[model samples]
Target: FRGRRGDTVKILWADADGLCLFTKRLEEGQFIWPAVRDGKVSITRSQLAMLLDKLDWRQPKTSSRNSLTML
Candidate 1:
């Protein structure tokens, strides 16, 4: 999905209603593409959410702090 359609992405999957198609386009910059396998690209539901948020869905990062306690 490059060139004139670089900003757009399409997701196809099967659900209870049978087949479904989702299309989205970013206002600026193109969506980061995932690796393709056998001519197809795939990602998890969580990854999809991260992708939509303009985060690196391939390996999303989160900040964490270790708890300091004395028992």
Candidate 2:
């Protein structure tokens, strides 16, 4: 999130005894920030995946695949 359009994103992380940094850039669509509070917020692994795909994080699960396979 340190770069602009067509640029690169710089992500810095720190753990127990090590520090890591990474970068990524999207070819289209602006980055969509998730809801936040006064302080930083975190999401679960499944929530993160939905956010990256720009889908509703709170969507209910359906069994459409089960019906389709039965047809």
Q: Give the per-residue lDDT of model 2 (tens digit) for 1-67.
A: 4344523445567999998987666676544444566755566877756555555677736666666
* Candidate 1 accuracy as TM-score: 0.65
Give model 2's TM-score versus the native structure: 0.47
| Span of 10 residues, lowest total lDDT, candidate 2 | 1-10
- The per-residue C-alpha lDDT of model 1 at residue 38 equals 95
Evaluate all candidate structures by whole-model CA lDDT and list the values in order: 0.73, 0.59
Candidate topping lDDT: 1
lDDT (Cα, tens digit) per residue for candidate 1, span 47-70? 878776778886767665655667
Candidate 2, residue 48: the lDDT equals 57
Candidates in order: C-alpha RMSD to true structure: 3.7, 4.7
Off by over 4 Å in 2: 1-11, 14-17, 53-71
